[model samples]
Target: EDRLLPLSVEISEIEALGGPLLLHSWREGIDDVDNDGEADEWEYSIMREITPMKENGTVKIDFPSLELVANGEFGKVSLYITGTDLAGHPVLNGGAPGVDNDMATLVTQDDLPTTISQPSISLDRWGNNLLVGQIHEFSFSLTDDNGIGSIDNISIALAPGDSRGDIWLDPLSRELSVNDNSPIHPVGLVIDELAAGSYKVKIQFRLGVDSPQSWNTSTQKPSVIVTEHGQVLELGSNSLSHLEWTVDGRVNLMLLSADDLSPPHSELFGNTLYLQPDDRFNFSGQLHHPANGLNVILDGDWQVNFSMDDNQNNAENWYTILSDSSSFMATSEIPQSRWNHGSATVQATIVGGVQTIPITDMKLHIVIDSTPPQLDFPVTTLSTINSNQMMQQLVTIRVNEAGGMGQNPLELHWSFRRHGVEISNMHGAAQLPLATDAEGLWTYSTRIDFDVNSDLLLPGDDLVIWVVGADLAGHPLEGIGTEGNSKMTQLRVIYFQPVLSELTVSPYQPTIESVFTIDGRVLNEGNDMGVVKVGLWAWQSSGNGGRYHILNETNLTLLPQQHAFFTFSQEAWDSGDLQLYIAINDDDTNLTSVPVGLVREQTTGEILWQNIDSPAAVGLMILLISVVLMVVTAAIRRSDEEWDDMDEEEIPPPPPWAPDEWPEGAGPPPEILTQSTSLLEEE
Candidate 1:
């Protein structure tokens, strides 16, 4: 019977191994599928199977081989074990199943890793033709199949004569090779080197591998292209394979690489720039110096400076690439002259760089305004005595333009003064009823009334109407400063009614010393009655007979339909034949006075005078007065009664009524019967 035996190898032989064996050992990887600390039994199976020679009848086995992976990477490897039984039949206890079943019988436990896989490479540059000073970086990663080893001991070499080969690799990238010395694993690498020649870089490297007995090796090759200094690598219009540039004249400015380019953290290699004839200037505010307030202006050449936190600090700095300030024409005009107002960019380059960058599209804005409205109106007086009263005038304000005009409602500042003396300030809107209309060609007006007793307003009184318009934007338009302010208009409220005529006093020719009463009447003969104000004073004329004067004016309510009365005492009259003068104002334009015949009243009862008259004349006057009285009486009586008083029979009363005269079979009429009989019995 066969029994299992403990197996092991001397540690010294492991170190003495060399060449392929050592390389194989180094390449071999460890695996522990179940996470146990100890190596899996299957790991020693391969070594045990590598037994002694058949003639010696000694069993022998070779070490299992694997590869290394980078740090933190998983590695893996697989092996087949075969053997024969004593009867000469192949030993089959855990042999792989038939082709159809193809199941693996060997088992493993623990987390040990197995084989290492080569890393991939990525190359990038900002522009075509990498310059000597410009560093190009190539990136790659190493990986493995199992969890055991690391990428330690991997050596990356650059084939000489290559542009990338002539430069130094980043130290950090070099350190990726020595991460783990245990077994097969992967590593990440970056090469940041550049030279002055176009090159096809071949990245060659050897990585650590592992075996059940010792160590092993694995190698890989990755390649990329690079350019030498001063070489113009022209990326075709559509080809982003190379770096891009913005070139104007001899200067070149590199556009960031299409691959792996981000703005906030993006790096810039050069500062001086130029514009190329073929490329369009496309710039965005983001690329411009930040403090410029994002505004840039391109006058002849470019005169706009970036704004600093303080404008005084940075305003003077200007950017002009090619032509002198006076010679260069602005390529484009945005909504506003300011570039910051618009999205814009420059297709430019650094002198001799011959590179171009596409400036993304940028934006511009424009802004118009108008003056406030003006007001003008006439001044007039409204007279109560005058039949035609003045209506309030409407006020309006006009604007020149819609924009920039304050869009608010109009407010009026109105004042009235007489004889250069200040009066009340009646301030109000032209929009409401108290004033007048607010629209139309700008003008505001309201009626002014004057009392007869009040200080009479004469011509030349200053009447001014003024206003300013405020827009919705709260901007007020001022005509005050410009030729526009007609500002104030002057006018007078005139009394334009005609004078009174035909003035007569009840008692004419009053005594020189007696207190004679006089009643006067005046008629408006002209177009209007400006006013009928009376003044009384005693006076005497030596030759023309004593004249009667006004003593006091009587207060009376004058209605529009008829004349208004004013009574004055004729007392203290010192005159021969009292002559009365009645003054009536037609208007500011006309004033007329009517003369009355004189009457000499010697006694109180004879103030009107008793003249000798014929009986015929008295009778005629009496008849006329009586006839007038009778007609008036009849008219008043006719108006008092609402209905006619005819009898019920004459009027043909309602259906139940009886007639006085019976027709054939009919009963007596209601007047004739007089409640003598009932037609129907009471219920």
Candidate 2:
């Protein structure tokens, strides 16, 4: 049976027919009819012959293999010949063996050459250095005689160790087709997001049904280095520098002020800064990459007078008021009127550029106080005390400083003087430390003790007291005094003839029935002879009223600065409560001593009697008495019931009582006999 071959068939299927399938051209006209080793006109024979292991007797056509070549451009690649024909001669310009001229043409997938050029890659921005957070385009190009349609697909991937491993190019792989008749084809991939790092981009292309091959540029693999935008370069004390691109070099600007300086001299309280009038306000910082080589300009309310220094001599040091080249520093005293406005702002800019760029800005609420601390003396200016006795007075002064409290230490200066001369032996011009009560307040309270006695102060002498203070900014105290001539008060020393100085009372918690002793000492605290009557007195309060009665009296005579002791005792007779004290009285003065003893009525008894006032104890005692009475009543009732229950026969005869056992009148009463006679009658 004869079979016809299909339009398309696999080589293996053709071989299953038991032999090679061959085709020959046939014509009615006779010309080289047998296709035997001859060349003739009008010939009908096989177009080409295949010979196994030997050269054939017919002409053969051999296709040239292709390889990739750099076109010395960014994104273009060229295809050239690499394989030769059977004669060991190179096939020039993608032509067959018979063709003499070079030409480019498109071919089908089945007619494609063995090898083709890979794609060349290029980036649209910054060559290989890319910035993060920006969109970039990568172009892939190829030049092949097989035309653009020969390419099946294009793929892009990132190398290992890349941070964006999960990211894949959109469409994963591109299926490219011919849009035009051009031999050179270009494809693009847009990457809109990428992480900040160095990455190697890999590109691949497949011609027709061939395996994918790697693609790269001429010098290196397609790569990119991504960096962060607007990166901070350096940080200094109270300043910062940022990197930014400009028409000039990269610009780095930093600003500084007294508010942000180290070892700060200004104080801030509730959004307002406090400063002294004499303090210097410093404004300084550095400026880098200035446009047109112009000096930095101040644009706001702050009129800074900047002075530049030669930076060549001090290149290793940071820019300050003393040295720098690209920096500015101004030291000026701020006016008090300007600082009183409650707030201020400073702004700087580089003005010589095409467009003004802001360098730095700072705003602060400032308060410059020229007035010193205010002092208000709350106690009397003059005080009087005896020569022998010591008197202490609390000198409280209310200080209202401009800034607040607890900023600095306040000093109290005191001195002793006789007439107009200061006594060097005594406490002269000494400082007393002060402590504040709280923080962040306008006023503070401090107290000092002023002692007046003969040891440091003589009769008719004076003790001078004053206060001095300063704020953190070195502002001195006001209203009270200056450091050299301070305002002060004097304490007067006088003569007190005799006084009951020390008094004692034995048994502080005394009972009403116990005797208490009152002892005292009379001192002559004057320069003249003194005589006084010392007496012990007791006072008791009653429902009617209260009165003091003299218990004992004694007369004493004391020389100047001499003291004597006196003792007295009194028997406690009155109940309730009483007070015992010693009193010294003279013709013109009467003085009472301290620590008067208080006596209360105390009852002597057992523990229960002592605690009789407690409700729990009283309740327990009543319960016990009720229990005893109930027991006695129950016993009596039981005895009566037994007596009544007994019959006259059960009573029997009373025990025989001998005459000797019955004492004269102590025998059983008549009631017993009457009961026995009644019982006998009943029986």
Candidate 3:
């Protein structure tokens, strides 16, 4: 068993022996978790009782209970008792005598007369209108003849009601002696979250037992009138008193003139208003208080201004104070020259009493675009379409507006006219698709179908087209047309068929071996430009009703009202009567044929005739001529024999009777004999 000695020493005597009494390694198996080579985990405390050969127990120090009582000229004075133990811990139930809790208590001394005065209330802005849902501060001074320390509990209540629970006080009640060093104690009370109503503040004070007094009941109570936010209140000829009051809220603004079919077109998207320059616009607004649900009137005037920088000092005057009413209406216009593009701020300022307040909620952001959208037709004026065939042409228009085109759809208006007369059934408007390029330029394009069947457009018919739309700022498109004077583009419908005329073959009566040229003129009768194919064809008269064959073909490109001459050459072979003509665009010209008796030489002295009506009669005529030639040759032979027998000298006279140079129709036709003699000489 370990031996321990009992010792009793005063704290001053222990400090005089040394600075302090300290023990090391007071407990075994104490771990130094921090590895600092010290047993710091064990708790060190002064022991109230000593123990040996056993585990140490918790030590507690008890302090003596205290009670305080005072009697003053005011009455049995109220006292608040509070103290801490030797270890600086708060004493439980440490208050005035006979109190079960720690709260301050009042002493009972019925023999003394009460001398404490009631609290005097001094509101921050007394008799002034208070705004609902806002915090209002007021103070009350408590006094006593003996000092404010003699006063104890204070209670505050609202007369009529506190049922809605909308009103709240920061410090609900004052307990005990709030200020013991001062003769008067001023307590500030903050009233917050108050609803709209009228009430009287009732204050009660307690200096001793049965010493409670009501301040409002003893004097004339000042009423606290809480008004709805934004509700205007009369200042009661005390303008100086309103200097301490705050005027705050917002303004709800709207544009009254923004509508369809009006100048100065405007559109509102969220909080921003887009505007286009025109003549003028009407603006209206009403004052709104956020604290309460009400539209309130301004006590003074309302002014409006427009600024590019959102600063009132740099803003331009838009509207002056014309009325003192809460709601306002004004007319204003933005000049095109002054504001061509970009944004501006429209601010409203309220002049109330002697204070000028700018309502941030009243400011509206406006995007002004004064520049009108420009229109351009890439394929403009004098376009042609074929009426004979169906075709689709892309009509494109370029729109140049810096403010961009709005989300509204664009329309293409077109009208069809024939001979300067409008065709009602062919005129209408259609939505056009828009596209944007890398350069930020917008273009609208639509494919227009031009069909004679569907459109009923004939040659010389004109179609006019234009675009109509507005930009983001509601600026209308200007000069949007395909032609001059901002009018529409005219697309003329025309037929591209080619007409052939003046068909003529060289040497109208052609021989079988002759090369004949067929010449003709191709004219484009329609108001269209294209290639026209012209073909040369020949028809030979045979037993079987004339066989047709194409001789030659050529392509000729012709413009509207333009003519081109085409020629084709072909070797006419084995032809009796040949009909030749020029064909163009699926149409034929007048037929021209080669007549008979146009002869061509096959071999020397061999004749081939073209366009012969009878071949057997020609063969009989050849046989008769052959028989006459034989008889003449026989007579010439006999005459030659007789002449030979007569005399050799007589041969000179026989020269005049040359058989080769006979008269016409002797031996053969004179032309044939001469052609044979000439052919023999060339051979």
TM-score versus the correct structure, for each prediction:
0.23, 0.28, 0.32
lDDT of each: 0.31, 0.42, 0.46
Give the candidate number with the greatest lDDT: 3
CA shift at 211, candidate 3, in angstroms? 45
What is candidate 3's lDDT per residue for 23-112, written digit by digit as tens?
Answer: 111111122235343323232112332212222233222322222222222222112223332333333342332223223333322231
Report the alpha-carbon TM-score of model 1 versus the true structure. Answer: 0.23
Which scores greater on TM-score, model 1 or model 3?
A: 3
RMSD of each: 31.3, 31.4, 26.0
The collision pairs in model 2 are none
lDDT of 2 by residue, 495-613 (tens): 44787677777766566667767778888987767677887666657788876677788988888799998877766676544555566773223436436455566756733465785
Candidate 1 residue 412 Cα shift, in angstroms, is 7.4
> Model 1 over residues 579-621: C-alpha lDDT tens digits?
3444443122232332334444366454333322457767877
Model 2 scores a C-alpha lDDT of 0.42
